[model samples]
Target: MSEHKPYTYVTASIHEGVTRFDVSFCTSEMSAKAFGGDGERPFLTLSSTEAHMTVTTTGGGPVTEQDVTLAREIFTASARYLANCERLHAEQPVNPTDQTTPSGEVAA
Candidate 1:
Protein backbone atom coordinates (compact mmCIF):
# COMPACT_ATOMS: atom_id res chain seq x y z
CA MET A 1 0.00 0.00 0.00
CA SER A 2 1.07 3.57 -0.63
CA GLU A 3 1.00 6.41 1.88
CA HIS A 4 -1.49 9.16 1.28
CA LYS A 5 -0.78 12.87 1.45
CA PRO A 6 -2.80 15.03 3.82
CA TYR A 7 -4.15 18.49 3.00
CA THR A 8 -4.82 21.35 5.42
CA TYR A 9 -6.42 24.79 5.43
CA VAL A 10 -6.97 27.48 8.05
CA THR A 11 -8.99 30.65 8.74
CA ALA A 12 -8.86 33.18 11.58
CA SER A 13 -10.63 36.23 12.93
CA ILE A 14 -10.80 38.52 15.95
CA HIS A 15 -13.93 39.66 17.68
CA GLU A 16 -14.64 41.09 21.13
CA GLY A 17 -10.97 40.82 22.07
CA VAL A 18 -10.88 37.17 21.13
CA THR A 19 -9.14 35.29 18.36
CA ARG A 20 -11.16 32.68 16.50
CA PHE A 21 -9.74 29.93 14.32
CA ASP A 22 -11.09 27.31 11.92
CA VAL A 23 -9.34 24.46 10.15
CA SER A 24 -10.08 21.78 7.54
CA PHE A 25 -8.18 18.67 6.58
CA CYS A 26 -8.37 15.85 4.04
CA THR A 27 -6.54 12.59 3.49
CA SER A 28 -6.76 9.49 1.36
CA GLU A 29 -7.02 5.94 2.63
CA MET A 30 -4.26 3.42 2.13
CA SER A 31 -4.91 0.39 -0.03
CA ALA A 32 -6.84 -2.50 1.48
CA LYS A 33 -3.73 -4.64 1.52
CA ALA A 34 -2.26 -2.22 4.01
CA PHE A 35 -5.27 -2.55 6.35
CA GLY A 36 -6.08 -6.13 5.50
CA GLY A 37 -9.45 -5.16 4.04
CA ASP A 38 -11.07 -4.69 0.66
CA GLY A 39 -9.80 -1.68 -1.22
CA GLU A 40 -11.94 1.28 -0.30
CA ARG A 41 -12.37 4.71 -1.79
CA PRO A 42 -10.37 7.56 -0.35
CA PHE A 43 -11.84 9.54 2.53
CA LEU A 44 -12.00 13.10 3.70
CA THR A 45 -12.38 14.57 7.19
CA LEU A 46 -12.53 17.91 9.01
CA SER A 47 -12.00 19.31 12.47
CA SER A 48 -12.11 22.77 14.04
CA THR A 49 -12.11 24.91 17.17
CA GLU A 50 -10.91 22.24 19.52
CA ALA A 51 -9.55 25.01 21.69
CA HIS A 52 -8.85 28.76 21.45
CA MET A 53 -7.84 31.82 23.42
CA THR A 54 -8.35 35.59 23.30
CA VAL A 55 -5.58 37.95 22.23
CA THR A 56 -6.61 40.54 24.83
CA THR A 57 -4.22 43.03 23.24
CA THR A 58 -2.89 43.86 19.85
CA GLY A 59 0.68 44.93 19.39
CA GLY A 60 0.32 46.66 16.07
CA GLY A 61 -0.82 46.58 12.44
CA PRO A 62 -4.24 45.51 11.28
CA VAL A 63 -4.85 41.90 10.41
CA THR A 64 -3.47 40.99 7.00
CA GLU A 65 -4.38 38.34 4.45
CA GLN A 66 -1.20 36.43 5.28
CA ASP A 67 -2.16 36.38 8.94
CA VAL A 68 -5.63 35.19 8.18
CA THR A 69 -4.38 32.45 5.91
CA LEU A 70 -1.88 31.28 8.51
CA ALA A 71 -4.51 31.34 11.22
CA ARG A 72 -6.90 29.28 9.13
CA GLU A 73 -4.22 26.70 8.51
CA ILE A 74 -3.48 26.48 12.20
CA PHE A 75 -7.10 26.07 13.22
CA THR A 76 -7.94 23.52 10.56
CA ALA A 77 -4.94 21.30 11.14
CA SER A 78 -5.42 21.42 14.88
CA ALA A 79 -9.08 20.72 15.26
CA ARG A 80 -10.31 18.54 18.14
CA TYR A 81 -11.07 15.33 16.26
CA LEU A 82 -10.28 14.23 12.73
CA ALA A 83 -12.62 12.11 10.64
CA ASN A 84 -9.82 10.60 8.61
CA CYS A 85 -7.16 8.23 9.88
CA GLU A 86 -4.41 9.70 7.72
CA ARG A 87 -4.46 13.25 9.05
CA LEU A 88 -2.07 16.08 9.66
CA HIS A 89 -0.81 16.33 13.20
CA ALA A 90 -1.12 19.56 15.12
CA GLU A 91 2.25 21.22 15.77
CA GLN A 92 1.29 23.44 18.68
CA PRO A 93 0.26 22.09 22.00
CA VAL A 94 -3.46 22.10 22.78
CA ASN A 95 -2.74 23.88 26.06
CA PRO A 96 -0.30 26.75 26.58
CA THR A 97 0.61 25.53 30.04
CA ASP A 98 1.73 22.25 28.57
CA GLN A 99 4.17 24.12 26.35
CA THR A 100 5.69 26.02 29.25
CA THR A 101 8.84 24.64 30.78
CA PRO A 102 9.37 24.13 34.49
CA SER A 103 10.35 27.05 36.73
CA GLY A 104 14.00 26.11 36.47
CA GLU A 105 13.92 26.37 32.70
CA VAL A 106 15.20 29.65 31.28
CA ALA A 107 12.95 31.69 29.05
CA ALA A 108 14.20 32.09 25.52
Candidate 2:
Protein backbone atom coordinates (compact mmCIF):
# COMPACT_ATOMS: atom_id res chain seq x y z
CA MET A 1 0.00 0.00 0.00
CA SER A 2 1.11 3.55 -0.64
CA GLU A 3 1.90 5.91 2.22
CA HIS A 4 -0.98 8.11 3.29
CA LYS A 5 -0.93 11.84 3.31
CA PRO A 6 -3.03 14.16 5.46
CA TYR A 7 -6.07 15.71 3.82
CA THR A 8 -7.17 19.33 4.09
CA TYR A 9 -9.80 19.98 6.70
CA VAL A 10 -11.60 22.56 8.79
CA THR A 11 -12.43 22.70 12.49
CA ALA A 12 -14.66 24.85 14.69
CA SER A 13 -14.97 25.75 18.36
CA ILE A 14 -17.21 28.01 20.43
CA HIS A 15 -16.09 30.06 23.43
CA GLU A 16 -17.85 32.88 25.24
CA GLY A 17 -20.44 33.09 22.48
CA VAL A 18 -17.72 33.26 19.88
CA THR A 19 -17.26 30.56 17.31
CA ARG A 20 -13.70 30.16 16.17
CA PHE A 21 -12.71 28.05 13.19
CA ASP A 22 -9.58 26.94 11.44
CA VAL A 23 -8.82 25.63 7.96
CA SER A 24 -5.95 23.27 7.50
CA PHE A 25 -4.44 22.57 4.08
CA CYS A 26 -2.62 19.38 3.42
CA THR A 27 0.87 19.63 2.02
CA SER A 28 2.30 16.60 0.33
CA GLU A 29 5.72 15.30 1.19
CA MET A 30 6.83 15.94 -2.37
CA SER A 31 5.67 19.51 -2.05
CA ALA A 32 7.52 19.76 1.24
CA LYS A 33 10.65 18.51 -0.45
CA ALA A 34 10.25 21.15 -3.14
CA PHE A 35 8.97 23.79 -0.76
CA GLY A 36 9.56 23.71 2.98
CA GLY A 37 7.17 22.38 5.61
CA ASP A 38 4.87 19.38 5.17
CA GLY A 39 1.65 18.21 6.79
CA GLU A 40 -1.31 20.42 7.59
CA ARG A 41 -0.93 24.18 8.01
CA PRO A 42 -3.53 26.73 8.97
CA PHE A 43 -4.78 28.34 5.76
CA LEU A 44 -7.75 30.32 6.98
CA THR A 45 -10.00 31.11 9.94
CA LEU A 46 -13.59 32.08 10.76
CA SER A 47 -14.87 33.67 13.92
CA SER A 48 -18.23 34.64 15.38
CA THR A 49 -19.27 37.83 17.11
CA GLU A 50 -19.79 38.28 20.84
CA ALA A 51 -23.57 38.10 20.39
CA HIS A 52 -23.22 34.98 18.25
CA MET A 53 -25.04 36.81 15.51
CA THR A 54 -22.32 37.08 12.91
CA VAL A 55 -19.31 35.18 11.67
CA THR A 56 -16.23 36.77 10.14
CA THR A 57 -13.01 35.42 8.72
CA THR A 58 -9.69 36.69 10.07
CA GLY A 59 -6.41 35.46 8.67
CA GLY A 60 -3.65 36.09 6.20
CA GLY A 61 -3.23 34.59 2.74
CA PRO A 62 -2.11 31.05 2.15
CA VAL A 63 1.52 30.53 1.17
CA THR A 64 2.07 27.24 -0.54
CA GLU A 65 3.51 25.62 -3.64
CA GLN A 66 0.81 23.03 -4.19
CA ASP A 67 -2.22 23.54 -6.41
CA VAL A 68 -5.50 22.86 -4.61
CA THR A 69 -9.14 23.87 -4.74
CA LEU A 70 -8.83 26.43 -1.99
CA ALA A 71 -11.67 28.67 -3.09
CA ARG A 72 -14.16 25.83 -3.48
CA GLU A 73 -13.29 24.48 -0.05
CA ILE A 74 -13.69 27.84 1.63
CA PHE A 75 -16.98 28.52 -0.13
CA THR A 76 -18.32 25.09 0.71
CA ALA A 77 -17.47 25.52 4.38
CA SER A 78 -19.01 28.99 4.50
CA ALA A 79 -22.19 27.78 2.86
CA ARG A 80 -22.46 24.97 5.38
CA TYR A 81 -21.95 27.38 8.24
CA LEU A 82 -24.67 29.69 6.93
CA ALA A 83 -27.05 26.77 6.54
CA ASN A 84 -26.39 25.72 10.12
CA CYS A 85 -27.00 29.26 11.32
CA GLU A 86 -30.31 29.36 9.52
CA ARG A 87 -31.30 25.99 10.98
CA LEU A 88 -30.37 27.04 14.51
CA HIS A 89 -32.22 30.30 14.14
CA ALA A 90 -35.32 28.43 13.07
CA GLU A 91 -35.02 26.16 16.12
CA GLN A 92 -34.81 29.05 18.59
CA PRO A 93 -37.77 29.24 20.98
CA VAL A 94 -38.00 33.04 20.75
CA ASN A 95 -39.88 34.26 17.74
CA PRO A 96 -37.84 36.81 15.81
CA THR A 97 -40.92 37.96 13.92
CA ASP A 98 -42.44 39.45 17.05
CA GLN A 99 -41.24 43.04 17.14
CA THR A 100 -43.59 44.38 19.83
CA THR A 101 -42.07 45.68 23.04
CA PRO A 102 -43.26 45.05 26.60
CA SER A 103 -45.01 48.46 26.58
CA GLY A 104 -47.07 47.35 23.56
CA GLU A 105 -45.11 49.76 21.36
CA VAL A 106 -43.73 48.62 18.06
CA ALA A 107 -39.97 48.31 18.24
CA ALA A 108 -38.36 50.78 15.93
Candidate 3:
Protein backbone atom coordinates (compact mmCIF):
# COMPACT_ATOMS: atom_id res chain seq x y z
CA MET A 1 0.00 0.00 0.00
CA SER A 2 1.21 3.53 -0.70
CA GLU A 3 1.04 6.44 1.75
CA HIS A 4 -1.47 9.09 0.79
CA LYS A 5 -0.19 12.67 0.65
CA PRO A 6 -1.68 15.06 3.18
CA TYR A 7 -3.91 17.68 1.61
CA THR A 8 -5.01 20.93 3.25
CA TYR A 9 -8.76 21.32 2.64
CA VAL A 10 -9.26 24.44 4.71
CA THR A 11 -7.26 27.43 5.94
CA ALA A 12 -7.60 30.48 8.15
CA SER A 13 -5.64 33.72 8.14
CA ILE A 14 -4.57 35.30 11.41
CA HIS A 15 -5.20 38.98 11.99
CA GLU A 16 -4.39 41.21 14.99
CA GLY A 17 -2.75 38.17 16.60
CA VAL A 18 -6.08 36.35 16.70
CA THR A 19 -7.60 33.69 14.54
CA ARG A 20 -11.31 33.73 15.20
CA PHE A 21 -13.53 30.93 13.99
CA ASP A 22 -17.27 31.16 13.43
CA VAL A 23 -18.66 27.62 13.57
CA SER A 24 -21.82 26.97 11.54
CA PHE A 25 -23.23 24.29 9.30
CA CYS A 26 -24.83 24.81 5.93
CA THR A 27 -28.62 24.69 5.95
CA SER A 28 -28.84 22.06 3.23
CA GLU A 29 -30.12 23.81 0.10
CA MET A 30 -31.95 21.54 -2.29
CA SER A 31 -32.90 22.51 -5.80
CA ALA A 32 -33.52 20.93 -9.18
CA LYS A 33 -29.96 21.88 -10.16
CA ALA A 34 -28.48 19.38 -7.69
CA PHE A 35 -27.29 16.05 -9.10
CA GLY A 36 -29.26 12.80 -8.83
CA GLY A 37 -31.33 11.31 -11.58
CA ASP A 38 -30.50 7.62 -11.06
CA GLY A 39 -28.53 6.79 -14.17
CA GLU A 40 -24.74 6.56 -13.95
CA ARG A 41 -23.83 8.57 -10.88
CA PRO A 42 -20.08 8.31 -10.43
CA PHE A 43 -18.60 10.31 -7.60
CA LEU A 44 -18.71 10.58 -3.81
CA THR A 45 -19.10 14.05 -2.36
CA LEU A 46 -17.85 15.18 1.04
CA SER A 47 -18.77 18.79 1.69
CA SER A 48 -18.30 21.08 4.68
CA THR A 49 -19.57 24.59 4.14
CA GLU A 50 -18.11 25.86 7.42
CA ALA A 51 -14.63 25.00 6.18
CA HIS A 52 -15.44 25.88 2.58
CA MET A 53 -14.38 22.35 1.71
CA THR A 54 -15.83 20.22 -1.06
CA VAL A 55 -13.97 17.00 -1.74
CA THR A 56 -15.09 14.55 -4.37
CA THR A 57 -13.89 11.12 -5.38
CA THR A 58 -13.18 11.06 -9.10
CA GLY A 59 -11.86 8.04 -10.98
CA GLY A 60 -12.79 5.10 -13.09
CA GLY A 61 -13.05 2.65 -10.19
CA PRO A 62 -15.35 2.70 -7.20
CA VAL A 63 -14.13 3.47 -3.68
CA THR A 64 -12.58 0.52 -1.87
CA GLU A 65 -13.78 -1.01 1.40
CA GLN A 66 -10.82 0.60 3.16
CA ASP A 67 -12.01 3.97 1.96
CA VAL A 68 -15.45 3.43 3.48
CA THR A 69 -13.91 2.28 6.77
CA LEU A 70 -11.64 5.31 6.86
CA ALA A 71 -14.59 7.62 6.14
CA ARG A 72 -16.58 6.09 9.02
CA GLU A 73 -13.63 6.54 11.36
CA ILE A 74 -13.30 10.17 10.31
CA PHE A 75 -17.00 10.76 10.95
CA THR A 76 -16.85 9.16 14.40
CA ALA A 77 -13.77 11.13 15.41
CA SER A 78 -15.20 14.44 14.20
CA ALA A 79 -18.51 13.86 15.97
CA ARG A 80 -16.75 12.99 19.23
CA TYR A 81 -14.53 16.04 19.02
CA LEU A 82 -17.47 18.37 18.45
CA ALA A 83 -19.40 16.78 21.31
CA ASN A 84 -16.43 17.17 23.65
CA CYS A 85 -16.04 20.84 22.75
CA GLU A 86 -19.74 21.49 23.38
CA ARG A 87 -19.60 19.63 26.68
CA LEU A 88 -16.61 21.66 27.87
CA HIS A 89 -18.25 24.94 26.91
CA ALA A 90 -21.50 23.90 28.59
CA GLU A 91 -19.59 23.40 31.86
CA GLN A 92 -18.28 26.96 31.77
CA PRO A 93 -19.83 29.70 33.93
CA VAL A 94 -22.92 31.10 32.32
CA ASN A 95 -22.11 34.70 33.12
CA PRO A 96 -19.11 36.68 31.89
CA THR A 97 -18.56 38.00 35.41
CA ASP A 98 -18.05 34.42 36.59
CA GLN A 99 -15.06 33.97 34.36
CA THR A 100 -11.57 34.14 35.84
CA THR A 101 -8.14 35.14 34.59
CA PRO A 102 -5.07 32.94 34.61
CA SER A 103 -3.87 34.79 37.75
CA GLY A 104 -7.05 33.77 39.66
CA GLU A 105 -8.55 37.18 39.12
CA VAL A 106 -12.27 37.22 38.40
CA ALA A 107 -13.53 39.12 35.40
CA ALA A 108 -15.19 42.42 36.21
Candidate 4:
Protein backbone atom coordinates (compact mmCIF):
# COMPACT_ATOMS: atom_id res chain seq x y z
CA MET A 1 0.00 0.00 0.00
CA SER A 2 1.12 3.55 -0.73
CA GLU A 3 1.34 5.98 2.14
CA HIS A 4 -0.29 9.40 1.83
CA LYS A 5 1.29 12.58 3.14
CA PRO A 6 -0.71 14.85 5.38
CA TYR A 7 -1.35 18.42 4.43
CA THR A 8 0.00 21.05 6.82
CA TYR A 9 -0.29 24.73 7.60
CA VAL A 10 -3.27 26.96 8.23
CA THR A 11 -3.03 30.58 9.33
CA ALA A 12 -5.53 33.29 10.12
CA SER A 13 -5.25 36.97 10.98
CA ILE A 14 -7.50 39.86 11.92
CA HIS A 15 -6.24 43.40 11.37
CA GLU A 16 -8.20 46.64 11.53
CA GLY A 17 -11.48 44.69 11.46
CA VAL A 18 -10.39 42.78 8.39
CA THR A 19 -9.87 39.04 8.36
CA ARG A 20 -7.36 37.04 6.36
CA PHE A 21 -6.78 33.29 6.13
CA ASP A 22 -4.27 31.00 4.44
CA VAL A 23 -4.19 27.20 4.16
CA SER A 24 -1.57 24.97 2.58
CA PHE A 25 -2.11 21.24 2.15
CA CYS A 26 0.02 18.93 0.10
CA THR A 27 2.10 15.79 0.11
CA SER A 28 5.74 16.00 1.11
CA GLU A 29 8.54 15.08 -1.26
CA MET A 30 8.58 11.48 -0.08
CA SER A 31 4.84 11.18 -0.24
CA ALA A 32 4.77 12.78 -3.64
CA LYS A 33 7.04 10.09 -4.93
CA ALA A 34 4.97 7.44 -3.21
CA PHE A 35 1.79 8.73 -4.77
CA GLY A 36 3.09 8.40 -8.26
CA GLY A 37 4.81 11.75 -8.48
CA ASP A 38 2.64 14.41 -6.91
CA GLY A 39 -1.05 14.02 -6.02
CA GLU A 40 -3.06 17.17 -5.80
CA ARG A 41 -0.73 19.82 -4.38
CA PRO A 42 -3.12 22.21 -2.75
CA PHE A 43 -2.36 25.74 -1.54
CA LEU A 44 -5.06 28.17 -0.51
CA THR A 45 -5.13 31.74 0.76
CA LEU A 46 -8.03 34.00 1.53
CA SER A 47 -8.51 37.63 2.51
CA SER A 48 -11.65 39.49 3.50
CA THR A 49 -12.67 43.06 4.18
CA GLU A 50 -15.85 44.75 5.27
CA ALA A 51 -16.91 44.91 1.66
CA HIS A 52 -15.63 41.77 0.00
CA MET A 53 -13.42 38.68 0.12
CA THR A 54 -10.82 37.12 -2.15
CA VAL A 55 -9.18 33.70 -2.34
CA THR A 56 -6.59 31.79 -4.36
CA THR A 57 -5.32 28.22 -4.50
CA THR A 58 -2.76 26.07 -6.27
CA GLY A 59 -3.14 22.48 -7.41
CA GLY A 60 -0.66 19.74 -8.35
CA GLY A 61 2.12 19.95 -10.93
CA PRO A 62 4.84 22.57 -11.16
CA VAL A 63 2.95 24.81 -13.59
CA THR A 64 -0.54 23.90 -12.44
CA GLU A 65 -2.95 26.76 -11.82
CA GLN A 66 -4.43 27.38 -8.39
CA ASP A 67 -8.10 26.83 -7.61
CA VAL A 68 -9.60 29.78 -5.73
CA THR A 69 -13.35 29.18 -5.88
CA LEU A 70 -13.54 27.21 -2.68
CA ALA A 71 -11.33 29.62 -0.80
CA ARG A 72 -13.39 32.61 -1.88
CA GLU A 73 -16.57 30.93 -0.75
CA ILE A 74 -15.12 30.17 2.64
CA PHE A 75 -13.79 33.66 3.08
CA THR A 76 -17.08 35.24 2.11
CA ALA A 77 -18.92 33.19 4.65
CA SER A 78 -16.49 34.06 7.41
CA ALA A 79 -16.55 37.74 6.55
CA ARG A 80 -20.32 37.79 6.70
CA TYR A 81 -20.33 36.33 10.17
CA LEU A 82 -17.68 38.73 11.43
CA ALA A 83 -19.43 41.74 9.92
CA ASN A 84 -22.64 40.76 11.62
CA CYS A 85 -20.93 40.53 14.97
CA GLU A 86 -19.27 43.88 14.48
CA ARG A 87 -22.54 45.51 13.58
CA LEU A 88 -24.22 44.10 16.64
CA HIS A 89 -21.43 45.34 18.87
CA ALA A 90 -21.51 48.77 17.31
CA GLU A 91 -25.26 49.06 17.82
CA GLN A 92 -24.90 48.95 21.56
CA PRO A 93 -25.22 52.37 23.19
CA VAL A 94 -22.78 53.63 25.79
CA ASN A 95 -23.61 56.50 28.09
CA PRO A 96 -20.98 59.22 28.10
CA THR A 97 -22.02 60.48 31.53
CA ASP A 98 -21.11 57.09 32.98
CA GLN A 99 -17.49 57.98 32.32
CA THR A 100 -17.39 60.03 35.56
CA THR A 101 -17.76 58.60 39.04
CA PRO A 102 -20.05 60.03 41.71
CA SER A 103 -17.23 61.31 43.99
CA GLY A 104 -16.32 64.20 41.66
CA GLU A 105 -13.61 62.05 40.09
CA VAL A 106 -13.15 61.14 36.45
CA ALA A 107 -13.03 57.46 35.61
CA ALA A 108 -10.13 56.34 33.57
Report the Cα lDDT for candidate 1.
0.42
Arranged by lDDT, best first:
3, 2, 4, 1
> Of the candidates numbered 3 and 4, which has the greater lDDT value?
3
lDDT string for model 3 (38-98, tens) is 6543333444433443222334345567656755786798799779978666665555556
Better of 2 and 4 by lDDT: 2
Q: Per-residue CA lDDT of candidate 2, range 1-108, in tens? A: 256665656678999999998655443321211222364334333222221112222233353333245546757987997799786555544534776544455555
Off by over 4 Å in 1: 1-6, 29-108
How do the candidates rank by TM-score, highest first?
3, 2, 4, 1
Q: Report, for every candidate in turn, its global Cα lDDT versus the true structure.
A: 0.42, 0.48, 0.50, 0.47
Candidate with the greatest lDDT versus the true structure: 3
What stretches of model 4 exceed 4 Å from their correct place?
Answer: 1-67, 93-108
TM-score of every model versus the real structure: 0.21, 0.29, 0.40, 0.27
Residue lDDT tens for model 1, 19-87: 987754443322111111154322222333332222211233455566557656755864634534223
User: Model 3: how far is 45 from its true place, Å?
Assistant: 7.4
Give the local distance difference test score of model 2: 0.48
Which 10 residues in a row give candidate 4 its minimum summed lDDT? 28-37
| Cα distance off (Å), candidate 2, residue 17 | 34
Model 2 bad stretches (over 4 Å): 1-68, 95-108
